[model samples]
Target: MKKEKTVTMGVDERYSQWKSMVGVLYDWLANHNLVWPSLSCRWGPLLEQATYKNRHRLYLSEQTDGSVPNTLVVANVEVVKPRVAAAEHISQFNEEARSPFVKKYKTIIHPGEVNRIRELPQNSKIVATHTDIPEVYIWDLETQPNRQALLGAATSRPDLVLTGHDDIAEYALAMCPTEPFVLSGGKDKYVVLWSVQDHISSLAAEAGSNVKMGSKNSQKATESPSVGPRGIFQGHTDTVEDVQFCTSSALEFCSVGDDSCLIFWDARVGSLPAAKVDKVHDGDIHCVDWNPHDINFILTGSADNTVKMFDRRKLSSEGVGSPVYKFEGHEAAILSVQWCPDKSSVFGSSAEDGYLNIWDHEKVGETSGSGGPKGANAPPGLLFRHAGHRDKVVDFHWNPSEPWTIVSVSDDCDSTNGGGTLQVWRMIDLIYRPENEVLAELDSYRTQILGTTP
Candidate 1:
C-alpha cells in the first residue's frame, strides 16, 4: 500500500512539472476529462475552415459502466490556427476541467466497448470499429441518427458488418488507403480482407442527401447488411495483434502477431504469405504501420520495449528478417507507432511508459543539441517526448489535415479518481521548423521589437 502511494505521488510530481512547461513546449493544448476510459481515438474530416480556426469532426468511444450504454462519439472540435493561441491561454488548462474547444455533436450507443476505430481514407465519414467480437462493424457517421446513451438503451445498429474471423478480433483493424477495403487480424491466427466497393455508392448517396434514414429506436432497427471476406490469409502461428494495408496498393498488406512473426501478403497471388519474417521481436508485436510517404519503410512496436524499422525490399520468405534500425527509448512496451503523414522519415510512438515520442531517422548520427556527455547518451533518433498523460497512453492519432497536431488518450482511472484523460496538442513551430527559417523569423521579430536587425 505504501509503495502504491509513493508511485502515485511520483506521477503527480511529474505531471506538475509537465504542466509548468506547457507554454514553452506546446503552441496549443486542450485537456478534456473523460467520464469513462476510451480505448481508441481518431481524427475525422475537416468540416469548416476560417481565418483563425477550423472546425473538425473527431471520433471517440466511451467505454461506460453498465449504468449507461457504451457509445461511439462524434464530436466537433475547434482547432486554433498555427501561431494563433497565446502562451498564457495555452498553459492555463485545468486537468480536471473540460476544454471549451470540444463539444459532443452526436452519439451512437455502441453494441459493445469499442476497442479500436479506423476511418476509410477514401471516405472519411465511413469508419470501421473493432469490439470484443470476431465481426467488424461499419458505420456511416453522416447518415446514422443520433441517440442518447441512456441506461437500458438499445445499441445503435451498424450500417454494415464484415465477418470472417473465427475468434475475437478485439483490436487489430485497418482500412485500405487505395480502395474501400478493410483488413483485420484476430486470435484465430488469420488476417481477413473485405472490400466495401459494392456498398460505397449507396453510402455516398445517402451521406450526400444530408438526411437521416435509420430508425432512432435501436430496438426496432432493421438487420444491417453483412459482407463476407474476399480472402482469409493464414500464416501466423499465434494470435494476430495488428494489420496494416500498404499505402499504394489495396492488394498488399502486412500483419504482426503474438508469435513474434511479421508476414506480408499480396492478394493478387494467393492466400499464403508472400514473405515472412520470424522473430521480428523478442516479445509479442502489438502494433504495425506502413509508411505512406515512403512505402519502403515499415514500423513495428512490441512488448520488448522497442520499435524496429524494416526495409521491405530486404525481406525474404525463406529466413529470419533483419531490421534496418532498432529504436530503444521507451521504458515499457510500446502500444502504438505511426509514420507521420507529413514527413517520410519522421514518426511517432506511444507506450505504456506514459510517453509519446517523435523520432526522425535522418538525425540518427547528429550531434546532441546540448553538446554535453549526458546529452550524447540520449537515444539516437528521438526528437521530442510528450509526457502530459499520467498513465499509459492507449491510443493517439496525428491529424493529417492539421500539421503536427495530435489527439492522444490515456486510461487514467486509477490515478485520476476513475476517469480517463484526453489531450489534443501541437508542439511549437520553432521546435519542428527548419533551423534557418526559424532563425530568419527570429531576426525579423528582433528588428520589430528593438528597432535593430541582427
Candidate 2:
C-alpha cells in the first residue's frame, strides 16, 4: 500500500489574504446592506394578518432631506360580523360572507366606500373615516393602539359625508408637505382646505358636544372653538378627481378631473385658478401629482392611455398647451401615476394594461409628435412589467424611502383573494437577476488563487 502526502500553503500568507478580502467585503456591506427584505418572503405574515384590518393602509412621510419612508399595515379597523354595514366600508364584504372562514351573522344597510384618508396635522396620527358618517376614526401611529378613536376631534360630527359627483367621494385630498392644512376635493366640484389648527379646534368642539350630552355634574364644555373654511375652490366643470398641494409653494395647489383640464389655484386666493392646462389630456385625467423632488414640475395620468409631465417653469413662458414630455404605451387607460421623490428625472406610471412603465425624463425626447411618447420613437424605457392581478390595478404607490419599492392594489374580477387583494412588489423585481454573474466571476478568481471553492 502507498501513502499520499498532503500539501499545505503558507498559513500567515493565506490568513492575511482572507482577512484583507473580508475587510473589503465588510466595508461594501456596511455601505450598501439591504434594508428591504425579499418582497414575497418578508411580507407574507403582514398580508395574512391583513384579513383583520381589511383595508391596506400605506402611509408615507417625507424626511427633512426630502426622502420619504412608507409604512403599511392592515388598516386597524374592527372586523365585526359580516352583516354589520360598517364592516362593508373596509373590504371584502360579500366575499367574507361567502368564505368558509367566517361565521354567518346579521347585516345592516351598506355604507359608502372610503372617500379619502389623511395623516393628521402636526402629529403622527392618521385618520380614515367616511365623510358621510357622524364618526371619523383616528389612529395614532405613535401609540400603535389596538383600537383608536372612531370619532375624530370632539367637535360636532358632520351631517353630510360628501362624495364625488360620480360616486367617488374621495375625489382628492391634498396635504401640504410642510403645513398642517389638507385640501379635500368633493363630488360637488368644490375644494375645501381643512386647516390643522382648525382640526385641533375640532377637538374642542368635540368636547363641547360631550358636555351637551352630559348632566351638570359632568365635565364642562372644555373650550369654545371657532373654525372657518379657508374658502371653497371652484373651477372644474365636472367632478375634481384629484388635487395636489405644491411642495415648493404653500399657497398653491392644483386640481383636475373629467374635464381634461388641470386648474392651478393659489389656495390663498378664492377658488379661481392662477393658471390652467386646458388641454393636457384628450380624456378624463385620473390622477395628478406634483414632483416633490422638483417643485416646478407636475405630472398627470389620464384615462386616454397617456401620461404627461408639465414643466411649470417652461409652461409659464411657453403657455399652458405644451408639455415638457408625454408618455404613451399602455393599451388600456392609465389608472395611476407617481413620481420618484428622490429623483425628478425618474417616474413610474401604472395602467389597466397590468404593466408599470418607468421613464427617464432626461432621455425622453422632446420631438413634436402625433402618436405620443411611446409611438413616436421616444426613449422611454419599460422599467418592468408586473402581472399578478387578474384584473385592473387601481393604484400604484412608490415607497419614498426605498426608491425602488412600489405597492399596488387591485380589484379581483375573478375574486382571487376572495374579493380584492393588495400586492407589494419591489421595483428591483424589474431588474433583479436570479444569479449575479459578477459574483460568479469573483468566485472563480478566488477558486484559482485558493486552490479550492472557498
Candidate 3:
C-alpha cells in the first residue's frame, strides 16, 4: 500500500510538470505558426449571452456564510445597449440572426458562480468598482439587488484621466492594497495616483460623473481635491501596461511598459526610478506583478515569450543586475502572468497561444534529448498547462479567494463573437484533494497604513 501511494504521487507530479511543458509548445504554435482563428471554438454564443441584457461587467463576491453575491455593472449607453445604437440593430439581430435561442442568457453566467469567490470576511462587503472612460466609481454589493452604482463611496479620485484606446481601455485601475488611494494606468504612457477622500466626495456631490476623453472634473461644486495626489508618475516611454504596490510596504511600487523596462518606484521620494533595468525582455513587458505572500519578489511577462522572476532584495544588493530566474517555453508573446496566492512555488502565465502554463522553481541542466523536461527543479520549470482560450488571450486575472481558479479575457470576432469573452477555469477540478478549507486570516499581521478597515 505504501509503495502504491508513492507511485501515485510521483505520477501526479510528473503529469503536472508535463502539462507546463506542453503549454509552452502550444503557446509557441498559436503565436508564431498563425493558426486559423476559425480553428478555435467560436466565442459568439458566449459573448452574446454576456452582453444581451444591459450588462457590461459582472462580479462575484462571496459572503462568509458560504453564500455568494453577484452583481452586474451597467453603463447606460442611451439604452438599447451600445451595439444597438438605435432600435434597428436590435430588430435586425432578432429577425435576421441565424440562431433562434433567446432566454435571459445574459443574466445567467455560464459555468455559473466562479470558484475564485470563496467567502467574504464577516460583514465585509463585495464592492464592484468601474470608471466611465475617464472617471472611476465603485458599486456596493450589499445595496439593492437592482445593481446600482455606488456613486459616493469610491476611495480615490484620479487627477489624470483617459477614457480608452481603440474603443477599449488598454489599461486597468486598482486600489492600493493598503490605502484608499487608487492607481490608474493604461496605453496613455502615464501612471496616475488618486486620493481616496477626493473620490468619495466627488461621487457624493455629483449625481453621476462624466469621464470625458481629455479633460478632468477640476470644477468641484463644494469640496476640494482631498489633499489631491502627491503627483503623477510619468517615466514610461510607451503605454504603462501594469502597476502594483508591495504587499508589505506602501512606499514601494512597480510599473512595467512596452519600453521593455520594469521600474521600481519609491512613492515617498523622487519621480525617477529608484531602480531600473532596461531591455528586461526581448519585447515589451506587458505585465508586472508582486508575489502576494512575499513582497520582496516580483514577476514580469513579456512579448519575448518568457516569464522572469526577480528578487528585489537581491537586485538591491551590491552589483547584481539580472533576474534571479527566467522561464522560457512559450513561442509567442506572453500577455499576462500571476502567482498562485494559496500555495507557494505555484505560478501561471498566459499567452497568445490560448493556454495557461503553470510553473515551479527548480535547478536543472540542459539535456541533449528529445526535448526539455516539462518541469524541472530550476528557477522556473513548466508544471501544468491548461488550454481554454479559442483565440489570442489578452488578459488573465487570478481569483484572490479561491486557490486554483483563473479568469481570462480574449478578443473574439464581430457579430456574436465580436468584442471579447471571459473564460473561467475551475483549476481545483484538476487538483488532488478538493476540499481544503479556505481561511481568511493571514499568517502574520501586516500594517494597514491607509484604509479605515479593521
TM-score of each: 0.93, 0.59, 0.55
Model 1 CA deviation exceeding 4 Å by range: 199-221, 369-377, 445-454
lDDT tens per residue, model 1, 1-454: 9999999998888788788888988888999998898889999999999999999999999988778898999999999999899989999988888899999999999999999999999888989999999999999888788998999888888988889999999988999999999999999999999988645444546456432323243224367867789999999999999999999999999999999998999999999999999999999999999999988899999999999999998876584678999998898999999998888898999998888888888878887632111355668887778889999999999999999999999988777767788899998888677789988898779978788766
Model 3 lDDT per residue over 329-373, tens place = 676788777777766566778787555677654422432211234
lDDT of 2 at 66: 12
The positional error of residue 217 in candidate 1, measured at the CA in angstroms, is 17
- What is the Cα-based TM-score of model 2? 0.59
Question: What is the C-alpha lDDT profile of model 2 across 113-220, one tens digit per residue?
Answer: 333345533343433333333222233333332222122312222211222233334546666767766566656777666554454545547556532111331223
Write down the lDDT that model 2 would get: 0.49
Against the true structure, candidate 1 reaches a TM-score of 0.93
TM-score computed on alpha carbons, candidate 3: 0.55
* Angstrom error at residue 432, model 3: 7.3
Best by TM-score: 1
In model 2, state the lDDT of residue 345.
75
